[model samples]
Target chain A: MSSDPNSTSNAAAKPADGLNDVHTLSLVVRDRPGVLVRIALVFARRGYNIGSLAVSPGAAGGFARMTITSQGNPETLEQIIKQLAKLVDVVHVADHLEHPPLEAEIALVKVGVGEGSDRNQALHEVALEFNAVVVDRGKATSVLRLIGSRDELQAALSALAPFQVQELVRSGSVVMDKGRSVLTDLLQKS
Target chain B: MKASVDTGAQRLIRFLEHAGVEYIFGLSGGAAMPIFDALVDSRIKLILTRHEQGATHMADGYARATGKPGVVLVTSGPGATNTVTGLLTALMDSVPVLVLTGQTPTFNLGKDAFQEADVTGITYPVVKHSYLITSAQELPRVVKEAWHVLTTGRPGPVLVDLPKDVTQGPCDAPEPETIDIPGYRIPSLPDTEALDRAATALGQAKRPLLYVGHGAVISGAGEAIAALSDKLQAPVVNTLLGKGAVDETGPLHLGMLGMHGTAYANKAVVACDLIMSIGGRWDDRITGKVDAFCTDAVRLHVDIDAAEFDKTVTSHIQLLGDARRTVEALLPRVRPGDTGAWLAQCQAWREQFPLTFESPDDDHLRAQHVLSRLNALTEGKALMTTDVGQHQMWAAQFCLTRANRMWLSSGGAGTMGYGFPAAIGAQFARPDTPVWAIVGDGGYQMTLCELATACVHKLPVKVLIINNNYLGMVRQWQELFFENRLSGVDLEGNPDFVKLAEAYGAKALRISHPSEIDDVLSEAIAYADGPCVVEASVVKEDNVFPMIPAGAAVSEMLIERPTEKLEKPSGST
Candidate 1:
């Protein structure tokens, strides 16, 4: 359901620890049709579950950047990195985890405020505590939207226990490693 | 890019042109402005989309249309994140797409950076491979590697994350190399021992059922599969994905099996002594509850993916390699079995639950009639790309799929709006093949903008829009499930699709009368100068019968319109 390959695999096999052990990498490519299929086929063919992903284009016309998280030992990540480096559209690749970066995801969880005004208030209070928002409210249920780190959302979900969880949807994780130098430096002397 | 002077942006565009990339689809964003500026005078065409998801889907459409790797470019953060759904669609459907995203500065990597999303991590599982360029110098080599990974193996999405600084950084334009994957290659031949055991199994079986799946289609082994089916005197049952692997008109053909499959096909599979599955995984939809599936059959599973064999259905014999090669090797070894009893049982079931469509009396646009007319018009020379919906099922059922590699539909992904773009891809792959995109109203609107792509490329793909005024599949479900609650399925106001086609600079034709189908289709197909759209607005309430209401077993299917209803169908009566 979620496009995140690692999430599906992780859900199927809950690694006792978390996904931090996984290797993460990113790249820039020309944005074109079926690019995702090309990427997925590589991972699927090799039986690798991508942990997280975010993609966007560059300031110029033809290229875009894509970041991928994969759960594997160093050797597997090396193989993936090497493989990714070989695509014609790929312009660059890096290990963001090695660089240390800020990462987060947004999730919208719809819950049933069953049987009382207190249950509704409780759900709203939890959202407020997490700095979340109520994206939509309906007669039967209220949808609470949260944007935060996976840890934060998980904490928020745990806190909102009384209301029966109706549906859970999440935006794929996005990241940028922190530093002072802007990406535009290569094009212009800052 | 000049030999002596190559900006990071120019280097990226030049790399794309060298890789044979024809077009780029995405919106201009803050992080991507420098790259767009570089592409202003480049050979690679840039197409801006309404949204990032649309950009990816457009690229997916292009890939499906051209069989060339589709390319997408989006900015970091929101632009990057919006691509998940499109990436997911391509991933599920097996489209080769290359997605590129821009990031903030490398130094601003982890401090909750602005417009910063880890495109690689989020897409890791969804894509075949992904990368974040730590250094600008590595761009050229990485680009080459992305292509190799995309086209070589089972093609899917690949992503590359470019830090803004890195995209703009100067580096020697590295020479592109013919990248060789050390450990990734599609094996051509199965292990000799595995083939030997498979041949032995073929030699012994009294009644073998050739259960073909999408792998046969993927491996381009449909003809070989049919030949082997004949050599073994086996009835071939196809999964939904494997619809045209073996000709449906052939005597040995048993239609389809699994969810939405024929009753006789399911019975034949269940009752067979040996079921040799080529490229099928015995997915839950096809097998129902695995324990209760093909109980009597000794399954001979052949697949390129070794993990698929015996992963679900128990395999008596397994062949791991190309389906055509495996089947061809076993063809000489397999001897005809005295399957009179087995064939008779299969025939009996077929007679009991035969696939039929009533020839519509009122000149009303009938789905089956249109398909049959299209079949007659093309004479099995065309390729069919169907969007997943009621029309897809109808097209699969009614169309005469005699040629190998003629059927193209989203089997694994069941994606809508897939037909038009995918048809373009299929046509591009084999330019000689006349490709028809059979899409329903709802599905056509999903990726309708691909019309421009087709026109721009001068692809003369015929578009057959089966307009039923609703999301036919979901409506069918509502009719079956919620007793026609019809919530969220119906379209409130639909555009005149025929005129809409003309607006896109395409030839448009509409066939409302049953009698007009032949003439309209001929004229549409005859138009070779540009793309064409033929809207067949069928009678609104028509239901695709042989309906297996969701969760009901294959046997509990409605084979035909009820006797009372059929008998009372004449308006005069």
Candidate 2:
């Protein structure tokens, strides 16, 4: 008797600080057309808004690794993961925050250097403090790259806000458990 | 064995025979001619359905009626798309079906050739797994592995998309082997620690409810569930598909517990302090509002699918294993006690708010009354297949099936036109058992062409079309919620169903008066020779009660209208 799930629960419980309660999900899914859309539909159908999403070819061929950051109640997110795992195309799903997993995000900060101005030197200092690489040093701009946790990247971006930051791009956090096992080895052998 | 042919299609037939696929329901098309040729020599019987959707539903019916997997063969394009609803039905209900679809020639791959569909791509989300055959030699291994996946833990439909060229190539694939899919895992054994937790919960509760779902049927754990419930003396509420998991007539059984379920069943769900959900997902229909469903209950769910727990109602203890194994393991581990006061309260609710329908004063009969009388006559011994509508709900509420594998319907997809063909499949699967399809006027018209298939096969199955000249369920909804501005629900121009049945050469009967049900059913159903159809023109605007509207909590169930019986016509039955 389970029908259209748009109304899964009456008015999903959204905490006062729900927008800030970010959850990270890792998914291994079959690489096929509309696979991403299908996975997104699972989350969207559950009324969870995506904070950020990143997908890359997985370690195993013919599969993709998807990292999703969303803000919702842990209960609802757990339900969403269960729904996702129910999909045949989804190989494995994990909540990184529930376990000890390695998480990283890379960002590029191109600040307007103003042709050898003090801002360029200050940006260099900030890059050194945050272990960011000076990827490019053009006449009018200095593009610095930062690879760190979401919080660290946010702090670095805040630090570079003083300089005239021209353009900024960040890859959403990608996560995997910090252990000897992989999703395929764990899920397949379960 | 004599030297046999090595053609891919022939080898596939041999594999299906080896897997004990006795019946294959399908419709032939351009891409699958070789397999049809091979089937001429195969041992399996082919049930050529009037439509591909009916074929899939029939397979679904067969699989649900029997514990074994059902097999289906269809060609590509629309033949495959027509299967979507049926596949979704099986996938949602976790019934095992193997769908073999013949794809366009491999060389025509992405050219959108005649009757080509990306079957694998389209069905990825609905199937347990699907494979587009890339090698002719791998056909045997694919068949073996597909069987394993189809029948294993948390069983669901699996699709094997066969390219036509592969059917023409030589099948020199290695002999079948035991399933060794590295990524697939059977559910874990009954967790003793989890059982210990559940036992403690069950031991402490004063108001415990045993809620059985289709998982009990899937695991063949009806006896175990009944034994557990008997020992605890807890009231049992079945989900729609869980009707037969516990005999509906059992003293402790509180018939289905959801929308349009018995009032007592819905009341028990909200009032019970402890709810042990067995093999049920607590779907939105079951749990009207997830947060408020069993607000005060200490929840424990035993499901083969681990994904069920916390997905809807968060459980305190989750037994992640097969229902049979889990129930068997916990039978001795828990302390035996009865919910005396709690049981009394439930009994009070059951007694005070029993299911009832007013005796209309008109000559036209009430649909539910007919279903109830059928139950009385058959003693709930017949296997029932129902199409979705008011009739399906009435059947769920009235049909008193006494055992598992006797109630089959399109529970998940709620597909119309599913009952007649499914009745065909169920009768074929269980030749000795009486199979009756309880369908509505609107749904019956969708697949009435199948009456010929039934007559041709000479299967002794009875079909009761509850004729109200409208899509009763939708009409009821519109009447209640849409201020009676009924839109597309009317079917006043429906063909005379009895005449239609006679046209197909099946025994037919038409009953309009309330007094004719018993005689007509007894003569045509119990004593019928082959296929039979009974079209009963039921009272119009008759609504199914005990409904929990969408997005409402179970506690807020709309039991009955204030003037519902006041408007009943004069001739009381």
Candidate No. with top TM-score: 2
DockQ of each: 0.02, 0.20
Q: By lDDT, who's the top model here?
A: 2
What does fnat come to for each candidate?
A: 0.00, 0.12
Docking quality class, candidate 1: incorrect
| Runs in model 2 lying further than 4 Å from the true structure | A1-19, A26-41, A47-68, A84-92, A98-100, A107-146, A152-172, A176-190, B1-5, B176-178, B360-362, B526-528, B563-573
> Per-residue CA lDDT of candidate 1, range B310-410, in tens?
44455666677878788888777667767777788889988987777776776577898899889888988888888888888888777867755677777
Writing each residue's lDDT as its tens digit, candidate 2 over B1-573 gives 124647778888988898889999999998888898899998899999888888888898899999889889999899988898888888998999889999997899889998888887778668877778866888888788888889888989999988888886787767865755543557856567889988887888888899988998888888998988888888899998887988888888888988889999999998887899888888777888666777667778898876776665666777889998899898898886668988888889989998988875457599988999999888777999999989999989988778999999887778899898888889989999999999999988888888877888899999999999999888887787667789998887889888888988999998888888889999876655789999889988898988887767789787886344222111111
Q: RMSD in angstroms, all models?
A: 14.5, 5.4
Model 1: what is its DockQ?
0.02
Q: Candidate 2's C-alpha lDDT?
A: 0.83
